[model samples]
Target: MSPKNLNVVAVAYDRLSFFEFGIAVEVFGLPRPDINPWYRFATCTAESGPVGTLAGISLQIDRGLKTLDRAGTIIIPGWRNIDERPPERLLRALRRAHDRGARVMSLCSGAFVLAAAGLLDGRAATTHWRYAERLQRDYPDTQVDPKVLYIDGGSILTAAGSAAGIDLCLHLVRRDFGAEIANQVARRLVVPPHRDGGQAQFIDRPVTKCEDTRLTSLLQWLQAHLTAEHSVESMAERTSMSSRTFARRFREQTGTTPAKWLTFER
Candidate 1:
């Protein structure tokens, strides 16, 4: 059986991160002549000539945004600056490709670009947890979920920062091909075959909101007392409430069941 042919385009921008761009090229743009009989890759810029990478290196791209026309999948490796506006041409190309059923992906803060193009509005999406709140604040129409490593919303996908890009790209390959082919590709690259999207983003600092003062107090108490066997009954007693009332309030305040919350606390 022959492997399916795929034209993967990695869109480059001025001040793009070299490491991020390299991740895309290594997976999509590299010549895999020995392993696959059919996959094509290209690095494209919004314009011709040299573009600077975040690592202070420059690369020459022969193709431009026009290449997206022939691509089966389009990827934005990473955004230059989350606060800055994406070039109008890039946004237009991405929007049009997505409209035509081409799979579109954004890695790291690249989700910002997709959100700017209105591709993520009303769809569940994720970015590096550090920018999740900012993404939500900037794009009120989008549904941002910060907990997961990636979100695959059919034609559109968003991945967290750094290594999670690898996870998302491999996931794409798996979806396009199958587990066996995807695993073979992963073995050649020496990367894991699969990482469930449910994996935690592993933020350096966890955010504790101030809205739930009592809950926060309870949480602190739980953290300080994890050594002791804790239960809903004990938690209710600490707050001077019945177990049923405590469980209900805990769910409402935290948006999770007590069991799941305990897992987090643990």
Candidate 2:
């Protein structure tokens, strides 16, 4: 659990998922001199042999489930089949790692694997929208949210799908490192640093492609002057727009209300 010697193990299985698994590798496996002492990443499988992927690629996984025991964090990429139950030994290994305080995370349909292991029982979790219903149906004890991008249940984290896996992984970095470090990592990946998992996965009315520099600059100013006493009316006046228009545009650009953004930034 030392940040300098972080150990992260990603579980691969028969018919491996390429996207989520690659996200784990990119986010945790790559060496980051910017953040000295990055995670030591390894891959393991439930059984053995080359794991076949949906993309028709074969992943050679030599490590076994026992690797979970030595990891400070365990990440489960998308499972091959939701209905295919994970081995009892694999489930037990995950449970043991959790009992000892190893962080567990799942991406997309991988939540099914965690659910099958009973780790998600009585906890809020989410999977890809397509599989959310099945997850809830199969695991009555787990609360499945079909909307948000990800769910951070402390030791257990679950993400919606593909891209959201990066969100969850960056969230882990933000928790272990900090916003600046996480932001650096995101920049390396050419993605935004801190997308709130609570943000709706989809939005009504297409988002505007053009950013209002006037409004964005105003927001930056507001952050630097939190103690200067500000209001929407004030911001609107500064941007030379009516309060209603400013508020609406701000939401469109930031994917959040101004009030929420200020509260979190402060």
Most TM-score-accurate candidate: 2
TM-score of 1: 0.74
TM-score of each: 0.74, 0.76
RMSD per model, one decimal: 6.9, 7.0
lDDT of 1: 0.83
RMSD of 2: 7.0
Question: How do the residues 1-266 of candidate 1 rate in per-residue lDDT, one tens digit apiece?
Answer: 43343888899988988877787887776777666554688878896579988788888888988899888788887798888989899899999988877888999999999999989989989998889999999998888989898889988999988899988988887887778877877887899999988898883433444365777798888778776777889888888889998888887777776677666667
lDDT of 2 by residue, 53-162 (tens): 88999888889988888998999988888878888888899999999889899999989889988999999999989899999999999999999999999999999978
Candidate lDDT (C-alpha), each = 0.83, 0.87
Candidate 1's C-alpha runs over 4 A off are: 1-5, 203-266
Clashing pairs in 2: none
- Candidate 1 differs from the real structure by a C-alpha RMSD in angstroms, to one decimal, of 6.9
In candidate 2, stretches whose alpha carbon ends up further than 4 angstroms from where it belongs are 1-5, 204-266
